[model samples]
Target: MGSELEMGKRPPENAGNTTQVQNTPPNTHILGSVSTQTVDLFNPPSNACCFCWCCCCSCSCLTVRSAKDKRILMTVSEKQEDVDTNKMPQLTLEEVHAWGESFERLIKSAQGRVHFRQFLKTEFSEENLMFWLNCEDLKKETNKTMVEQTVKQIYEDYVSVLSPKEVSLDSRVREVINRNMLEPSSCTFDEAQQQIYTLMQRDSYPRYMNSSMYADLIQSFEQLNES
Candidate 1:
């Protein structure tokens, strides 16, 4: 078959005999013959559309793995990129709860709920799906490291701006934080609300309210209260 799509110099006759180069689509230059057996430009395999595939392959290097694993890696990597760029998905109350349950199973940490919740601020879309996957990776790669890192970052970045004043709180807020610290995953809505109300006294409630530890505390309290 004639190489109608050929746009560059021909591949050397021996290109495939020794070198198995998987070139990309745009500006692809084959150093050997374009045979039927010659592999198509290594477009990453994806469930996503052509735009996503092209975007992924163009931006990222395919991993070194079995062809199947390579495809999986490329798909996952590109999916993550797309999710990061796209809006997050939306869910009804039931769907959100289901999603949370899935997260609880997969993430297995208080911080995971925090990460997933943070992601929910954006619209529910392919992008958020990818982000959820990435957060899972982050959870896996760093374990509790992310929490300490966040704590350190907050300490470094925000601490400098504020006077060395301790974060004053009403006893209720202190009690909530203390309870969560002891239980690690137990804080309920009423208890948490009391904490928040107490924090309002010091204007420190909102600052720590969105924290995963706080969320975990609330969640733990809820779970325990439910139990």
Candidate 2:
């Protein structure tokens, strides 16, 4: 009775079969171990080798997971690029002729903004144009969370008195901005934008119209039209 109990406790008489199974690939052993841990047999763990055909047979979960990770990374990269693009103003020749006609016409179009910004750069007042453009961009944002973040960034970069790029705003406007900052909104910079716009129209616009840069650009346009 003792011998029978010992034999029953021992493995199968096909000792060679047990040895053969033990000689199986390491990944198979890992798969079996993972299976015992309540892991979904259909979905292998991320650490598993995706190329191991025998161990990962019919299991494309790792491959799918890898692709999904790559897609998410790509999406984040694209969003970062968009943010950088937004921070810098865009220019186009969509209405180049209109811009060349008058300073008012030039300031109204995207191309005009680019040229005007170049002139402002020389005059050391480029912050005015940058601030105005940022305000315009801020107005188009509908996401409440994004609007709040953008408002803060604009205030820090162009509205704050300590900022190197700070626009020339009066004490009243500055006080209003400071009060509004406690509860920032998309329209927080409206008065500031209006003031800057008026400053450019009255001050910078006339100077730009009379500047050699404007005259040269107009001459080039006429030459192009004639050709």
Candidate 3:
């Protein structure tokens, strides 16, 4: 009752003539001092609060998960391409080896033709050769486009027929062979030869595709100069 009266009779210190009385509790003075000196130790910056922590953690997890998913997708795409090649007709080992050999021979002959054509272009007279020059240019342009199209076809076909699980080294080699052979711009004579040698050495062609049929096709094409 006495404390209540004291509180009710409290007055402002600056009220000089007013009926003023001190009503502040003695313990309140200690509380005020403690509160002022003891800083808010756990208080964080606005950007480092609980909501921010949650957001940061969530974002980090999502980023990691997304990266994993991307890697999985890329792996799946490659595997699908391998699968596509498996759907292609299987060839015996002997046939694949023979085909590889035939392909080598064809590549050699093609290189020879390229050399010959270049020689002619260099040595032939330029006078009255406008038509010939145009023809040569057109031929080169057509060949370049054809090779690009062929590589694309082989890549597509390989990706279409095989199961992702079954696509293996042999399939990869076949795809590489097709790609290398068709890439006229990048497949130099020496590079093509090296590719042929590598594939033949692997000895995977015989059992992977119809190696014999492929060999015969190559031989026929080479003999007829029908490339």
Instruction: Please give the ranking of all candidate structures by lDDT, highest first, separated by commas.
Output: 2, 1, 3
User: Global lDDT for candidate 1?
Assistant: 0.30
lDDT of each: 0.30, 0.54, 0.28
Candidate 1 per-residue lDDT over residues 12-123, each given as its tens digit: 3322222133434453222122212222211132222212221133433333224544443443334334222112232122332343343333234333333333332221
Name the TM-score of candidate 2. 0.56
Best by lDDT: 2
Q: Best candidate, TM-score-wise?
A: 2
Candidate 2: C-alpha lDDT: 0.54
- Model 3 misplaced regions, further than 4 Å: 1-64, 79-203, 206-210
lDDT per residue as tens, model 2, 1-227: 13211111222232111111122333322112211111111111222132321223355543444554444333221232122223334322225456656656876664467556666666767777778877877788887766665665677567655466667787788788877767778898999898888878877777776666665554543443454
lDDT of 3 by residue, 3-54 (tens): 2111112223332121112234342211012111111101100111112221
Off by over 4 Å in 1: 1-85, 90-142, 154-194, 197-227
